[model samples]
Target: GDSVTQTEGLVTLTEGLPVMLNCTYQTIYSNPFLFWYVHYLNESPRLLLKSSTDNKRTEHQGFHATLHKSSSSFHLQKSSAQLSDSALYYCALSDRTGNTRKLIFGLGTTLQVQP
Candidate 1:
């Protein structure tokens, strides 16, 4: 079965520091779309970035990630951390196996930024 894995459970950082959330995945299918979804305190989870092209960088909401099929990774990175950047982040892969494409998500990562 296909699965997504986020090695880091929690990341704590001070304002102005850089941040990285590790993400990796495994799948049996060849064509799959990887996504980064951010969930704030009250707002519903929303797609931050997504890409299926290997080695292409995708950016959204001040964050950027490049999917590397060779490494099976799509690590999210930000140049500087902001207090408002604290949130729950999830890495997901869409399995286009059948007529229905299912999204498999990694264990969520919580980012806490302090001023």
Candidate 2:
């Protein structure tokens, strides 16, 4: 019963504010690939950040996060939120070894930014 969890389903905020979407996960496997994907309405989910090795943080496209097996979490954080950054975000993890193609996705966190 391994899975990923995103606590926030909807986040509404004004422009120029900070935003943090909580992400906690659990997996029986020792090695897991934590990922963050951004989907801009009608667009496909794209890779944002991925943890290649534990404790080594990964970041891309103005977003950053690290997979911590000790805490069993990979939370996304950003200093200032932008109106254009508003979109549906997902915290995902790909299964280990032979199941690399399989991804466990959270329900998804929707962010709404107002100018």
Top candidate when judged by lDDT against the true structure: 1
Report the lDDT tens digits of candidate 2 across residue range 87-112: 99999977668944588998899998
- Candidate 1 pairs with clashing backbones: none
Residues 7-93 of candidate 1 have per-residue lDDT tens digits of: 568899999999899999999878788999999989999999998588999988789999998989999999999999999999999
Error of 1 at 28 (Å): 0.6
lDDT (Cα atoms) of all candidates against the true structure: 0.91, 0.83
Residue 82, candidate 2: how far off, in angstroms?
A: 0.7
In candidate 1 the C-alpha lDDT for residue 61 amounts to 79
